[model samples]
Target: GATDADAAVAVAHPNIALVKYWGKRDEALFLPVTGSLSMTLDIYPTTTAVRLIDEPADVVVLNGRPAVGEAYTRVARFLDLVRSRAHRTEHAMVVSTNAGPTGAGLASSASGFAALATAAAAAYRLDADDRALSRLARRGSGSASRSIFGGFVVWHAGDGDGTAGDLSSYAEPIGGEALDPALVVAVVDHASKAVSSRDAMRRTVATSPFYRPWADSSEIDLVEMQKAIARQDLPAVGEIAERNALGMHASMLAARPGIRYLSPQSIAVLDAVLALRADGVAAYATIDAGPNVTVLCARADAARVTAALRAVGDFVDPRTAHLGPGATLVPGED
Candidate 1:
């Protein structure tokens, strides 16, 4: 039997969406308005360890520091879900570490919650398969569901109605074995964003006139992206990725206050991507809810893309990421 002191650890990698997930039809359940697809990156992994404690409150330590406020509360609430499932009243101590920058729209939360959900389930003795675990992670962050799988993954938004909606929303892997792709992560600013993705997404959905158009087009993008991946068409994939990301930003820009995640340096990288395309290299850029830009290119062209972005002389440090593995439990640790 699993005891309150039994600890479990798991590691997960962050994934960048090719078809973005922006709005939520059910915010409480973290159900997205549309489906999304992504590629798990080789860089920026999060390792989390969880253990049930005999305390009245949960204790969380994030990246070696005592977490407070929203960060602590978020982890505590996630644990509450695990507790409810296990039928245990004991609290927990969660320690999470991120290999890359947290926030900054780099999908840190995706990795964090994925790792947390897996470890907490194991520590608390909850019997769950990957799909069940994906749903658990989705409760923490919509994108976290995709982190449960690696290489190429697609997250179904599920039906919007509250009746058994969560079961329909889960992430599954899309094979890309014959494909060799790379994501060049250009970090313009590593600091956390002024507005969180959750708030920004709601504002865009509520205020932006372009939101509906973007959401509708995202469905088509998801279909075409899957086709492109199946045939390993790098150019077609890049083209769809670039336009889809730009459209997402356009919807956000139409918001009342205008959520601009792209900075001048981000544009510089985008321009460099355009220049690379002009020179016969297939490259495309995407930005999440932060100033950082992720450029998708061929593995053979990754060095070229990295050099081109470095030539801009504005990015802090650029990293080229190959497709990474899915979430896995840490071996030989109890």
Candidate 2:
């Protein structure tokens, strides 16, 4: 039997969605109300190691520090899922580190859970294909499903009301080379989010009148975005991405009491992105559940986008990202 001293490690990168996924149809299963499309980025990976132990409870260490509070609970629950799947009662020790700050709306959970799923699955000697692994990652974080693949990926929300089981939701790669682009990440704030994306998502789905519209429009956006990627139409892709992201924010805003993730700095960066477009630089901005903004542009325009964003002074640091690889199990420490 494998001992706690023997660990399995894995690495996975974050992804930014062009077509956003906001609400969940089934929270327990982490099934989204609509499908989403995203590009896995080469920057800011999360490396995780898992070791099954004979202890009574799971242990989690993050970034060289013992994880506590909600973070520890989440990790323990996710490991419980892994243990259940493998039909093993042994608790585990999971240690993970994010290359960048966590919970800054940079999809840290996506990469973290993807890495954890990869490492834990291997450590437990579970037999799962890429699709099954993606589904397993999704149970930890909805966006994590996309991190299981590289390049352009689409997480299908899947069809079912409990009958479809685990197969109902999984992510797969979408083929397209002409539309390969770079993402300019403008880091406005690195602090952990005050209100979790999970809470905001639940509020939006339960109260926002625009929730239905957003879900409906996202379906259309997903189809059109796929076409844009296939044809390598930068303008079409940018337009769809910008509109889809804004629409997602709008839905959240319409929730009861409203959930505003965008800050003044986020808007300022948005202004700079628009100015670059007016100057014939094809740059479009998208944001997640935090104040940071990401600008999508041709790989050749990375410098221009970065410079323009820096000029705005709304971001402390601006970085560039390209298409990244899928999560993988490694023999040694990541």
Candidate 3:
């Protein structure tokens, strides 16, 4: 049903990795040191449209303003990849909008690039499968590979076997419908991060002594996480996710000069999550490279989790999200 078109718009949602993807094995290829498992959230969808224009240069507009700095560079570079694949030299205009804050640990880049990759593939008439698109999205953001699928997904680290190994690094969906978990996203802060995640990861990999140990343990965590999801064990899933995320932060914290993304507000939310769990609620906390925290709990406990998070009085807002669908090309949703 999908074919080449003059222009196309696509939508995708961000995915929060439970087993945490911290450092990259291949920086240029965006391959992780260890594989990761995640749940694609139903919230914060990114919509992007790409249209070929008869212009000398590509144009990029993000969230209602002309993209500048790293944002513009990433979009243009990703487009270059698509151009090379499609074998079309025509420049294009890319317009994108994110429903939530970008680069603030909300996985905005994940959804943004997934949507862009889908749109570009369709616009350029590149007949590629979902796995192929996942690889394409990974060029823009490491986690974006998982955004290609819905529900629970896994991104394989593949091998370090050069070009052939790169093919194994795409994300794929793993069934977990029975879990039906809910994620309560606590937004403590939404401002742009001073240090980008990529930079932070590089620093941690290069400097932190804890990085290797954590990376080693993460592989075992991934195995347990997959088992937990397979058996529909919400508490196990939550616990593994929380500890893995905390370990990721620990590695970052141990970096030379030490980098910290968790603020007082972030810790407050985390404490609340623990409190909820102690109070007989199946809840656990996970944080990304930024200050915000996401609470994992059973679907039935989402409202209670949200209320408890709000009572912490630290977050700007807290909302519940469920499993989301994969990226898709929309005819007019843009």
Candidate 4:
């Protein structure tokens, strides 16, 4: 007999890149090249619901499909990490939905996995804190680790314990802290790309000659980025983030296959950011493993930045934007 508890949770989507965690040091544990920073978006996000049941099999329904086989395996691996801590006996049923369009080049997986991890912990009544939850989410996806908390978050690639090699290990937050509350605006979401994050990272690690440089240089970038956030220096933060993102993508361009996520529209977005900077506007752009670009600006300039981008003619529709809240449990619910 299992004690049934309805656990419904939602997590905002986080666009990561500041000191980008380009290559994983550990594939199994979802470790990263170095530390990374991210801001959870208020617009696109994921919501999930979980219930404890006395069922024979662990079930997960993602966006209405019976998440079986590979999907089940992926989630089960994460649940195993949860169960190792909680020792829960009852099986769970999970249903997850993403607000943004799937394959829209958004960090849907990050938000979706974070919501699932949160919902699972709630359903099992695990008393783990946010750090533990963030660790569990890392086992699912490297970026998901940052989604466990809202605002600016950094995932420090921890040292591996010889089992998964020096690079193969889990990532945790640096300095045992989170980042300041900052807003992230999606400048363009329509230009979805072909390469998935997993594939892109794999290619970059194996083929890119600049991969080593990117990883080696990230340590310095991570330190400065953290300090900038601590000081609330927008310009410093933006400069470090914009450069780090470009460094990550530059590694991709130097890959043996030499593939890039940048499209003409992406270049246009970058140009627009530079144009804004030329006009004395404090704005910058950062991209992950996709063509979509996320602009990092202060809350006050969110409107002006969106308007400027919308006027670029090739931008996506619905130019209005707002600052988002961090991930949290729904009230009187989960």
Candidate 5:
């Protein structure tokens, strides 16, 4: 009954974590140790299409090239999950593209897996709601769960039994619509980092002395962050985000081999953020697992924030992004 005509396409945007979760408790299930909060951005979305094929193996194309090695393997494994759920035998042809640089700490995998999970679930005729879809996306990438929702989203780190935890862990949109902030992304490096986030996280969890302390402190920060968002306090939110990110990096620095993602240029952007605050501007910076820095500020201050980042370094290419909608199926795109 299944045919190539049974195809689906979906698009999803990247998200930057304000209160980030670093390590995982269950690596196989991709369950995080702590919950994280993020804001989905309007820029650099990934669009993916899944078409069932009668062939023996799945075909994967990523950003115009034939997906190979780990990229192809990850896609096939994710589709295998869909197949198991839908009771389908057909392999799929997966095509994915990103509007921005991939694997540069810009949440490329987040958007990619979010779109893939949506498209694959539909193509396999699996009846899934948003919560179910978010869980499915988490199997591919941890941050991808947040990409399933719009605006301010939180990914809950479920506890207790494995089955119950898997069922409970998912992302939902929180109430932060009043802030309407803009995130200025400072592109300090376009190339992918030598160490993947998974590897770095594992190392930090295993060897870092500061990991436990930061995790404990981050729990308190998350509670305070939710209250700040509830009060629509932008400065409070920025302060929490900046300190949380810095604490995460400190944990990384305490690792055995010292996994450092921030560079000189990253420090320069951070300096600019501090200078903006000194001048009474509400700008705060958050760095992911790479050299790039994303500054969160009011939409009115986005231009000022972008200008400051650009002036700091010749390598920094700043782009202003705002809150974006959640993942959706886009019809009529072949």
Candidate 6:
């Protein structure tokens, strides 16, 4: 068994995909239809502590409980991948905590997997950069491929073959890539989402007629979003992101056993955002597998956006909304 004192900890934040990744071409490798853009949030993230133990019973403890069975298998498989390059080492005990709600449809898995990959790599003294660590993290969760880096990140969805996919999977560091730092205002938190992202994507890919169109158009969206980011064009970026997110959800609606993540409150919040845009507010909303909405706005306009959200009924959390940092090691501690 491992003691707390012997553990190495890493902290990483969940990222919101600006260019949403909906359908996957290869389920086993978690390959997406096209590249996705994301920004790591500073407020909500996962912190993981990993320590090597001198026992054969590799174990994982998440939020205080012993992670057994499937969860253990998943983490073990990831560790096995890292161990292939790293020298054979003792089993490890890992404890993970998500700053945000675990099953709230947020990208907790992205940060959780990234933090685990980083802590595991550090605990074993593995020589790896952000990209290498990202590749390892991607094996654990598809969205996690971008969480390995901070600021802005793009995950290039390569060809379906494992080898080609690995080579094509690229993560770019775009934290300061834009001339202006963008701000993401979270409008709602803890809204109940009916379907989990995993289930939604699986169903969408298997049944949605619109899935093919979404996949086909992702390349254009990727190119335009990148250009908008490069130019620091907030309006262009927001337009592209909102459209991409809508496209993703549309596919979900087209699924055989169709389901909608949008709740009455979700639609209300979306309408409010559009109203803000019409009123000349430079803001837009994007959602993922959850009803919670994140608003993309300029850092300077964050206060105004927050005020606008507060003016609405008790549908949003003012405190939970804020700008965030990318995936990084804990200062002074790591």
Q: Tell me each candidate's TM-score.
A: 0.98, 0.97, 0.97, 0.85, 0.98, 0.89
* Clash pairs, model 1 backbone: none
Segments of candidate 5 deviating more than 4 angstroms? none
lDDT, candidate 2, 268-307, per-residue tens = 9999998998899999989999999999999999998999
Native-vs-model 2 lDDT?
0.91
- Candidate 6 matches the true fold with a TM-score of 0.89
RMSD values, in order shown: 1.3, 1.4, 2.3, 3.5, 1.1, 2.7
Q: How close is candidate 2 to the true structure, as a TM-score?
A: 0.97
Worst-scoring 10-residue span by lDDT in model 4: 174-183
Report the Cα lDDT for candidate 3: 0.91
Error of 3 at 193 (Å): 0.9
Off by over 4 Å in 2: 1-6, 163-165, 332-334
lDDT assessment of candidate 1: 0.91
Ranking by TM-score: 5, 1, 2, 3, 6, 4
Give me the runs in candidate 3 sitting further than 4 Å from their true place: 1-5, 332-334
The lDDT values for all models are: 0.91, 0.91, 0.91, 0.71, 0.93, 0.77
lDDT of 4 at 261: 81
State the lDDT of candidate 5 residue by residue for 126-158, as single tens digits.
Answer: 999999999999999999999999999999998
Per-residue alpha-carbon lDDT of model 6 for 195-302, expressed as tens digits? 767778989999999998987777789889888888878898889989998998888888999868877777877887888999999888888887777888877777
Q: Indicate the residue-level lDDT of 271 in model 4.
A: 89
